[model samples]
Target: MSSTTNYILGVFDDEDEVLHAVSEVKSKGIKIDEVYTPFPIHGLDTAIGHERTRLPIAAFMFGTLGMICALSLISYTMVFDWPMIIGGKDFFALPNWIPVTFEGTVLFTAFGLVITFCISNNLFPGNNVEPLDLRITDDKFVMAINLDKNKLGQDEITKALKSSGAIEVNVK
Candidate 1:
């Protein structure tokens, strides 16, 4: 069982307005729950104090695992499973393993990054997304502030949002 929280969605028509609103609201000690934009807004994450992601490290780790598996499999198949000689190449032909190893590394890195992103963003299959506004995914930028958590009066919240240049403010 879970509880539903009430939020005030501050709508802004421009990215610059949203950026300014984030700084303004935070400066006024009003915590922003989250911000949604139709597309990536440069410097918005930084303005909102979001930390840098570490997905690249995850990709590198997965790629290393794939490379190790590929190398081991190639070496075992060629040298131990069934020894073979082709084009006067050595049984443990390291050069022959490069292409497959590279492919495996690339494949694992791509898939790993995708999985990591989905997991990190909580986008599992059958998951439902509660959008504050349909236009948020289309053209609008919205900032959500949890009223219950912030413990601010509705009038005060509305005033803060309006002062920060929000085009519209609505409760949800």
Candidate 2:
């Protein structure tokens, strides 16, 4: 089945205006599709009702696996595979494993976070991008509303956006 949607893009010159618009729109019982801002604004997520992210939990799990791998590698090579006698240290040298284990933990955490973010967000190399106003990436703040999903008519939606401080509103 083919899907179709109508979106209204509300452009705000100031971040504060966009923030206010979000609260006002939601209070008016309208669902927001998305919002784009040039720079990260404090408290915007909470205003939009977005929940906290769980990427840190993934990072911790990856780091734990890395630690296990590092420990296994060191133990196998130094203790069983080829027993080494360096500075009269024991075969399973716990002290020497610290540096490699720390490095492995950090490496895995960094790589795992990047991969998880890309996969979770459906972002990958050479993916087609949806059309967006270039000015939104520079200075303007843009909010998108799915017209099909909103029960309010077009006129009422436009009025609400303009009343909420939208400098421009475009239908797409």
Candidate 3:
């Protein structure tokens, strides 16, 4: 779904093998497209040289937006629209709004991250992706390579992946 094509992907069985292979291959000047594992493995990003994620930035922006919206709504409702006094609290005191403001900020930030992640990855329910292998989501680890450069043929890439400690290497 990501327009990745002509890439050579090497799958691994053991997480350590993937980690060691990543570090070694990268040192040998070979580029990796992506790595996938059934569970999070430590230092996977570092070994693969992946850039830091942007989800936190998205969450912060959405949280700020939510805080602004909540503050504005509270101001309009308590001060301008209804001008209500609750338990002798001042009409515009921000302390009175801390609970709702905090709640809204967290809620919007979480939802924003989810939406951004889904949109950015193009992963949503009903957006069917051709599964590489069912086992990949269960017990196996997978690596997706983008081979648009057309530099290595099947045999050469296969040999490279096999030598890198891939338990099974096959083109799909």
Candidate 4:
């Protein structure tokens, strides 16, 4: 028999059950860490009481920061910082700064946003993941709670899951 780990928390049998359980849990004011599903479920976000993600805002801010940095660096280097006369033109010329500034801005912005995204998703080069269940990724739904280290009442959570329409429940 495959032994389930304590950190595995609780698993609910199906997607609908998981959704209902999430709603019920939220109604009881019990905060859930995360809900894993095989596929997208309509109204799942609301059921889990998840707020609108701030990822887009973070990406926008990072991109904007990158744009400003790139623009300033290019602009300053070509004009004030270390002005260089090129093609018999004025060192502080505006038109000539456009191409480099635009390119740098685009490059830095894309990189900054992408790096932020990777970091947020925990997609580093090598990372260990603790998946609650295989079926949760394929067909079932899993709800995990980060209880205060062996402080969880398994029976209570099991009862809650069943009451919320869990088709079946498991410790892992």
Candidate 1 C-alpha lDDT tens digits along 117-139: 99988899998876878999898
Report model 3's TM-score to 2 decimal places.
0.87
Q: TM-score per candidate, in order?
A: 0.94, 0.95, 0.87, 0.66
Clash count, predicted structure 3? 3
The digit string of per-residue lDDT tens for model 3 on 22-127 reads: 8765654456777878999999987777789988889899999999989889899999999977898888988879999999899899899989999999889899
How well is each residue in 11-65 modelled by candidate 4, as lDDT tens digits? 6666677777787866655567678888888988877777887877776776677
- Winner on lDDT (1 vs 3): 1
Candidate 3 segments exceeding 4 Å error: 1-4
How much is 95 displaced in model 3, in angstroms? 1.3
- Candidate 1 minimal-lDDT segment of 10 residues: 1-10
Number of backbone collisions per candidate: 0, 0, 3, 0
Maximum-TM-score candidate:
2
Q: How far is candidate 4 from the true structure (C-alpha RMSD, Å)?
A: 4.6
- Which regions in candidate 4 have their CA more than 4 angstroms from the true location? 1-16, 40-43, 76-103, 146-152
lDDT of 2 by residue, 88-151 (tens): 8889879888999999999889999999999998799887666567788888999989888899
Pairs with steric clashes in candidate 2: none
> lDDT (CA) for every model shown?
0.89, 0.89, 0.78, 0.70
